[model samples]
Target: MLELEGIETGYGETRVVHGLDLTVREGTVHALLGRNGVGKSTTLKSVIGQLPVTVGTVRLAGQQISGRLPHDIARLGVAYVPETRDIFGALTVRENLELAGRLAGPGADWTVDRIVAFFPNLAERLNNGGHELSGGEQQMLAVGRALMASPRILMLDEPTEGLAPIIIQQIFGKLKELKASGLTILLVEQNLNFALGLADDISLMGRGQIVWRGDAAALKADDQAHARWLGV
Candidate 1:
């Protein structure tokens, strides 16, 4: 459902992702795994139009999305949840979600009620400010807010970052539910087991390019691939 072809991106003069090609199919969870500084996040930024694709094009479904403005890309059914989980701290949880809900086009199926149902913990916290929630709660709010936009593909960068084990499991469980419901996801995650459990396809990135691509079972058995590409 999403494709990046020969994309090169960087910060100013410093190059990060170089000629990286990857694709996420419809209704599947594709995990992009890599150690720090491998440009996993950069790839997502490029897709979301937060960073320019210095070389190749990004396509959603079939149309080329390269060089479009961020908001335009978002309106075309791409929702990004950054590693920082950038929820509006001053806004109540309801307000935060409603802000994104306003961006939904006609026939949108995601509403505050649906989001609350999807995230049961959020139901009671709607009146609470973003800052009032714990780290896990904030992350839930971030994902829920993104869903409010009624996106076709949801990209999450390090959804497990900075959370306790229990919370991480909760997040993973919710992601599995989303996957079962056929919401396409492109995930960049550091947690090895978490990624393996959820992704239908796995791509291991090294130095700004995809070095290995395989399914979870193949990766799980290939200890050499794990050690060489993943440092496992």
Candidate 2:
């Protein structure tokens, strides 16, 4: 379980997220949907300690974590997979995964072998550098690396961005499996169809805060909300 209350954060003094409040219940996938620049990524960054929350509290399982360091937040079982897929380009696929596990300092349920198996495509790419992987493979590596930390809640930003349709389907399937395994996920995605397929609950963000909240069927039926808030 994770909660953000009245969060205000941004780059320098230029605020992007304004009074944003969101919550992810245990063992559920909650999708944060929005157009570009609605602060979906910023909210994730703020929760992970990449950006400081100026006004409001971020709580994970009822423990306040807004002011903590990124590594510290990670140690508390919060893992983040940014849209950039920030893997170490110089390191081999195995090295990239092993490094995260090593930094996590034991007790991680995910191991290098486990990650490789989870992303079967990575099994043969073990000795290849991160730079050598395709976009899909890189995305898988990014998710796999995050899993190495044995996170309680995983936050992903734009996981389906700029990928082939087939690759997106693969990602969707993997996420489905993750959800079935009871891993809590907070997803910031622009792909409405993808989000609807995986999320149990969906929240729409406009400007910088939530404008609508509902399940997939409810979202589909809300033409007014879509037209007004989503410009559909």
Candidate number achieving the greatest lDDT relative to the actual structure: 1
Per-residue lDDT of candidate 1, residues 91-136 (tens digit): 9999999999887898898999999998898999999999999999
Per residue, candidate 2 scores C-alpha lDDT tens digits across 3-114 of 9999999999799999998889999999998877888898999999999999999999999999999999999989999999999999999999988886575666899988
TM-score of each: 0.98, 0.97
Q: What is the C-alpha RMSD of each candidate to the true structure, in Å?
A: 0.9, 1.0
lDDT of each structure?
0.94, 0.92
What's the number of clashes in each of the models? 0, 0
Kindly provide the TM-score of model 2 when superposed on the true structure, using C-alpha atoms.
Answer: 0.97
The alpha-carbon root-mean-square deviation between model 2 and the true structure, to one decimal in Å, is 1.0
